[model samples]
Target chain A: MTMARRLRTKDLSAGYDSRVILKDISLEVPAGRITAIVGGNASGKSTLLRTLARILKPKGGSVLLDDNVIHDMPSNAVARIMGLLPQSPIAPEGITVADLVGRGRHPHHGLFSRWNAADDRAVTDALTATGIAGLAERDLDTLSGGQRQRAWIAMALAQQTDLLLLDEPTTFLDVAHQIDVLDLLVDMNLSRRTTVVMVLHDLNLAVRYADHLIAVAQGGIHCQGTPADVLTEATVKTVFGLDCRIVTDPVSGTSTMVPIGRHKSGSVGQEAQSRK
Target chain B: MTLIIDTQAAAPASHARNRGTRRAVIVLNMLGLCLVGLIALTLSCGQGCLPPAHVLAALTGADAGGADFVVNDLRLPRALMSLVVGLCFGLGGAAFQVMLRNPLASPDIIGISAGAGAAAVFAIVVLSLEGWAVSAVAVSAGLGIATLIWGLSSGRGAAGARLILVGIGVSAMLNSVTSYLLLDAPAWDRAEAMRWLTGSMNGAQLVQVWPVVAALAVFGGLLAVSARDLDLLRLGDDAARALGVRSDATRFRVTLAAVGLVAFATSAAGPVAFVAFLSGPIAARLTRGGRFILPAAGLIGAILVLAGDYAGQFMLPARLPVGVVTGAIGAPFLLLLIVKANRNGGTL
Candidate 1:
């Protein structure tokens, strides 16, 4: 399934109030492929995601979604076509998982419209897709970290939008859960062809999971392309200030970075395996 | 991913079951029954030892002139005022809590009632006004307090704490203004202003009570129309917006409804302190409902004011104002809330 639509920005500048956080940054997120935006702590990765999500309006950039400027698009319309999972989005206390996922259907369900079979089907499908069908009745707070994140994703999925954006979805999870969530995203991309854009801290995971890469640094796009093309040693050093050995992951056949630290022996190359 | 495979507890139809509503209905019915008893007691025992039988007889249009006059003309209106005002305060406050997603968002404590009282006081002492014009003053004052609180709390998306704090500030300012007006004015108007300052149900007649009843109808309808949206609002803004609810607009309407509800009740009976605040929490606690239960909370509010009024004047040698009774009962409850909120880090 080749769903190759594209979201592009032309000279977009945005920030909080008057402070310019993202400079005249321009990039394209090709649909039907995961775009991992990589940068250090203040590289404006999250801001770019929010701007693309239309939660924060850009000052001067034009975000064109299939020729319709997303800035000019009604937020609900944008929200309907594209879903966003903001980092650390707080759920209302005591709301159940099914209720949380049910919220994703809100964009589809107009006021005064009765809940129908399709809504139920979509909610069930989202839960099943994320493998939370059994825990669908559980309170959101009771779920473990990874399970909760998947629930949040299931909420985004239940929107049934063609596009999905996630910010640091793996921030608090353990490595095993991180793999579980990334695996789900990969499966979602393959099966549904949902355009996925995310800010990922793990460099190797970004390369492994994302088909396209966007490296943001100093309020601008530093590099963007296929993961292997963008995840060069020079880009890594400039963006993350880490000397690393780049290798193709034997299993996934993607660019994987082994970060080089000073703790290794003088002759020993920096093959810092984070978690095997 | 500790999926644990628990099909029993997923977040779907299990939440939509009728338990919350059932609890609310039971509590409201009991409260309603007690209110009926309190009203009967109020009509029967006040300065006249008229038997419950006589009041019931007069209420049924039997021909006893003295009993008819007291039951139909005097105490009935007072009791009805307590009922209506309490409903206004309770339901209105509950609606506010659901709207703002905060327990501290009640009309009585958050300066809306203070705004009405302040405006009414200004109309009386500063402008030397009288009669139904105070209702208009009340509407505007309550609206003003709401806007000020909204303006102050805009940064935090009008979090409960911010609204409560800003409301307290405005209420304090208005209260001081009221005190100044009362203290500086002539002795002739002094006694009259005092009743307006403290919430009162004394000297209330049906004609005077109509404004509150009417206000409750309009405001209460507005809230009911928006009740489902208000219920979704307690789920946080993103979740609410995701649910296709135009949240900010809905919030505005809810605020307007709350202001109208409290302002009219204040105009009719004077800021019957904390009934609005207490009723919502009590209802939520008792019913364990998912979101705002406005009518249920309102029933509790009506019961509190009516029962408090009954216990106050008749239970004592001297007649205590309805507001005094409510304060005496509601203060300790407020203290308990403060302690609970403090222990829970004050978010409730």
Candidate 2:
């Protein structure tokens, strides 16, 4: 796999209609590594990812691909190098998994081109990589949530881009499924040297899975670095507006954030006295 | 899993895709055959009930006595008009439904047909226009109304529902305009306008058939070019864009071509009631929701118009207009679909 592709944003501003959600945010994604953007609800993490993916047009500045303005390039040319899986994508009623995944080859063909052997191989490989090859003939509506998400990921995989961006991929899944998805992403990153960037709601999972972490706050990036450097208590307090303690994760040997709420104080004496 | 298991699992996926492709091909061929049979039956069995040989002789420009005038001048033009007009409605309607991701968003339901109807009525009654001039006015008005509806409903999110609702409102308004025009016209002009408004194959000239045929060629060609891109749009704007489809451009091209098709057909055929609304869903059902439904839908549209015209003229107690018969069939289906959607919590 080519490791020359680089995705970066320079002083970018973007939003819906008139309301700017991300303002002058600048960041570079490390190629062939897993990067995670984490934040509280509506903190522009998704907006930033969408802007980079060119799903949302940047209001000012630019998202650059190998130092070229992404928006200025032909959309199909950019799509050939990068793929994005949105937060919620609709499946047409009664579409089979293989058929849906094959749609990922959209950028590879022109208006009059027929599906070739390469297209078939890409779809097969994607389905196999996502471990949903067995469910290829099944209707998407019949799949479990995890399996459905896997199908969607398989679609992005079929695109065969060097860069993959995902927005809240594990939002509706169980914890086991969340880990399953993250592990799959890591596998892709390691095996294919495919750059993976995702917006994660779970801070600990983001810290655990991502090699680099970016914290977003109030329409701009608050902090960014290695997980250990960026997931400190001060960054969490500022970015999420929540009091939290950062500790070493025993499982992953990475930083983990444990939020401290009004009632769940870890004082043993206070808990005992309240019980008495 | 080993390579053996992987190949085994992969087999069914390819098999399913092949099966779907095969099914679509078979269904389209069947629809084409049915359309041909209907056209043949229509030609051979009207009024005096000429034989196939006589009809064929007339069609081939060999003298078949009095059969020449009836077959060449009358039934052939009407059947040809139905064929082209049906193709236009089916293709245009399915394009709208698929692009909007709603089965109910056909041109007739969305005021495009009403626009053409209102214009034709205005031309016949007020402007005193005749022949091709009336068709030209109707086509222009249909295109104008489509543009207006698209502009009104387009925005950031949930544009499909907004477009459908806006179209319904516009349709109602245009229908009222058509009615009001009819109410004040002279008796002879009123009768002529009413026949046009209700959509009839009566006086379907060979000249009128050519414009719709030309429309089917140009606009249908445009639609064919964008067919794959339009199918991708079914996955929603974000996904389509990520897949490298220029969603806005595809939508624009599709909308323009589809409107051109509906407008031209309406101008020639006078807004054949519900033919546009009914074709897509019927074709979808017949094809079992295949990936490419436009061609099947177009064939179905042709069949419906041809069959409805034949049935209305012959089978009905009174010789009714084609629109009335199709309207009767379509209105009940629309109600059933709405009811089913409502029961499913407002999804179709």
Candidate 3:
């Protein structure tokens, strides 16, 4: 893929009132790849994502896309090219699945612009891409956690942006649903070559899916590399302070984890081994 | 009970409901006609009954024999004022409600009306603005108060909920200040201030109609131009900005428009109580979730105040103030809304 400066942040410092959360952070979100951001809890992972998306302003430095300052552009202009789905998106009461998906076309529209064939095509493509095309007419509030996540993803997809940023896309879902959402992401990556940046709590999933890993720690990046190299047992211990044995997954040959918490380490591993 | 999860209930709800805009237009036109009917009823229904034909004749200067002098002058001004007041109140109220995305965010309940009223009251009592100048200053004050609220609420993006809360607070302070001024005035001036404060169409004239009409005409057009932006605003600042909306600029422009609208309404009608709060909800309910209820709200507000004015003036021959009747009707609606909000689990 031909790579250019899609989004770059330089010496960026941002925070809420009175205290700075991130300082002197410089980073690049590579175009045409899935860049998984793996960090321990409270490492300003979400803050970094929000600043890149221009939802929060940096006190210092600049976030640039194609050499244009992000803060300078009208939000719709930027939104027409980039989509961000924050963790726990709120839905308007009684918003139908179609309506929620349709709102994703907001940036592409102007005042007095009616819903046209293009908007409909975008929404239809998004819902189908997210594998929720069958349920396009359903109310969003009534969808399951997994299905609702897809709906939200569909909304982002309708943006038709080259870059998609998701903040912990699999936060509250069950293990099965987490895999479902990840599979959808894989489909998107394979089909569209859409540049994806996301913060993931699950290090194993991060290792499994990411083409590149950006690991943030203590207000700045601790390391950035391919996940196989950076997600060793020692790195895991240092970042999250949990003991885990890393092994290749028998199915996909990606890294899999054998977590060791105090309560049930030995017997659980044996029971798992017998089952396998 | 089974929660039906049909993905194919009516694919692309808007496509199925292709009659959406048409239905809304038809309903709105019907509502407009209803408001006109209410105005006619208001004009000629009380103390002396005049034929509807004669009432129309009196209105257009077509009455040859001049059999409806009562309808032509006194009742006509009252009806006109109600129509104008209702339109302004509805537009302003509905604008605030949808813009804030909170039903509690109406101009009256959130203190937009009080802010305008206080400024107008100050102009009348303290600044001693009289005749055309009195209402003009009042309008300016109303705009000034709205500007102050919007300014106070300004942040990096769209006006946050905190800023709106601050506006509510500012409105409270202004209301108290207005009360104090009214209390300290000379008895004669106190009576005059009280009438305006409570709101009345009793002394309103045809001349007063032009200012209100003109204010609505100018400010209402600005609001129409900014309507789509306001619709996007209900999605919250972060969501809006992330979607490539210039949240700050949009908020600033919409706010300026809202202030202009609110100020003009207050100047013309002395804050007219709950029309601003009620009109938007009524219009939204009738429209079933269309964004920015300006035209429909204006019609509903016109009907409400006109009907309320008529009721106040001659419903019982008791000669109650229009404000009193609106308060009587509006207070119950407010309580019902609160109960509904509570039942629905939280804020809209």
Candidate 4:
């Protein structure tokens, strides 16, 4: 792809039939950069992504891709420019990795065009991109969680879109796998300048990897900016409703958040000894 | 990057593998066709008393003495009915299985076939209707029942399991009504009602084949056109939509086509028990892959009906209806599936 396209929401309001989950949300996604959306449970982070991807119809307002209303564009046309990886997508029984990834080429072909060399190359490139080329013949059910996640990312990558939206892509993975996924996204951004938007729960990782961070709370954007500007202690308190200390990570030179709870005022052992 | 080079290098191997999978699918389909042909030949051989050479001669349009009427007139329509009805049921069943993402969600299990049966039996035993009137009512009733199930299951993105559970409950209730109508039926009408109840190919007319042919053409064409989207639906609604498959529209079209297929078949063949339920899993097992084998399943269904009728005619001491034999065979498989699904804890 050439220069990544811009995705923006204009006064967007959406929800499940008659109940609004996101309200009056207006934002512009920076082209060709990594952005992470962080929020508490049911904070409409995923819903926002779904609406922007045109999976859910917005009750009011619209999402735009390069000034065209995304909802108004043909779905396949939108798909050519943007791709989404949802939370916990199902794999059909007995599907091979190659077959599963090949489905991602669906939007590229016309109704009667058979799968040709180009489609095969795209699928293979996806498998190679995700480092699962050797496992192409393996069944999806047989892969480990991290490997499965990588395979799904490969499927999205096969679309070869300029923009990608992922919802909690690292939810079930171990710590190392989480970092592996983030690192892979960063690599894609650097190599292809693909615009990346993701919903993540790991605050420190978000700070380390995201060029822009969006904090959502109460059906609106609570904060949006670079991590250093958006991860301040006051903003964290407003967004998460938790008291927390913000410090710089010595290794990555990025902001890290340490939350304080009601029970622990100091070191636990010291507090117990003083009470005794 | 090296990823591009590695992908290019591995392309030929993966290309060969793709060809291999396609070959397996084609071979399985060819095998199904051969089985259907074999069963058709067996069905036309006339009580096993006629020699195969005589039957072959008759089939080749040569004069075969007295066996002409038995082979061409009586056996041909019934056997052709089995094939057509089987295709409808099999295609509809596999479509349901793929779209609903559940193996057990066949039209028969989900009450669409029963809806047609109930209406047809009611027309026969109570309203005193027959032929095309009965078929029309049956089709409408089947669509009505599918609509009802669709309504009940449409509760804010309820999953496939919910629709199936509701369908099982609804089918059980409709079956009771059918049984009651059979009991209260006049003695003369009881036999016809009973045939519809168990589902049979007995006395099927050559004229009756056209509706099913028409339905299969229209709906089968629709299915072929939407096969790619239907396959993408296996990834679930969100992912399918993300892939630009109009998920809701594709699902609606597939469901409509599937319901139309089974309804037309049921009106013609009296709901031929379990052909729809068995063909999808059987085809999947035969093909041994994840791709939807609509045509293969249709062929398997034809084989099942033809073979079932043959077994009913010759295997037992007293002749039985095709429906009875299929039911007898299918109930055991259904039981096996239930036991397996129970063991697997809700995968079915």
TM-score to true structure, per model: 0.85, 0.95, 0.87, 0.93
Docking class of 1: acceptable
- Sorted by lDDT (best first), the order is 2, 4, 1, 3
Which pairs clash (backbone N, Cα, C closer than 3 Å) in model 3? A75-B244, A76-B244, A76-B245, B86-B301, B86-B302
- How displaced is residue B77 in candidate 3, in Å? 3.1
Error of 2 at B114 (Å): 0.3
Off by over 4 Å in 2: A268-276, B1-13, B130-132, B187-191, B345-348
List DockQ for all candidates: 0.29, 0.62, 0.39, 0.58
RMSD of each: 4.9, 2.7, 5.2, 3.1
- After aligning candidate 2 to the native by TM-score, how far in Å is the CA of B28 from where it should be? 0.6
lDDT tens readout by residue for model 2, A1-276: 646588999999999888999889889999889999999988889988999999999999999999999999898998899999999888877788988998999999987889887888888888888999888878888999999999999999999999999999999999999999999999899889999999999999999999999999988989899999998878987998777778788887888988876565678435544655
Compose the digit string of candidate 4's lDDT tens values, residues B257-310: 888888888888877889999998887776654564677788888888888888
lDDT of each: 0.79, 0.87, 0.75, 0.83
Q: Report the candidate with higher DockQ, 1 versus 4.
A: 4
Q: Which candidate gets the maximum TM-score versus the true structure?
A: 2
TM-score of each model's B chain?
A: 0.90, 0.93, 0.85, 0.89
Report lDDT (Cα) of residue A154, candidate 2: 98
Model 2 chain B scores worst on lDDT over the 10 consecutive residues at: B339-348
- What are the per-residue Cα lDDT tens digits for candidate 4 across A1-276? 546697999999989889999899999999999999998888899999899889999989999999999999998998888899999798876677887888889899889998777777788778877898878888788999999999999999989889999999999999999999999999888888999999998877888999999999999999899999999888877888776788889889988988766566567435544655
| Overall local distance difference test of candidate 2 | 0.87
lDDT of 4 at A168: 91
Interface RMSD of each: 4.2, 1.9, 3.3, 2.3
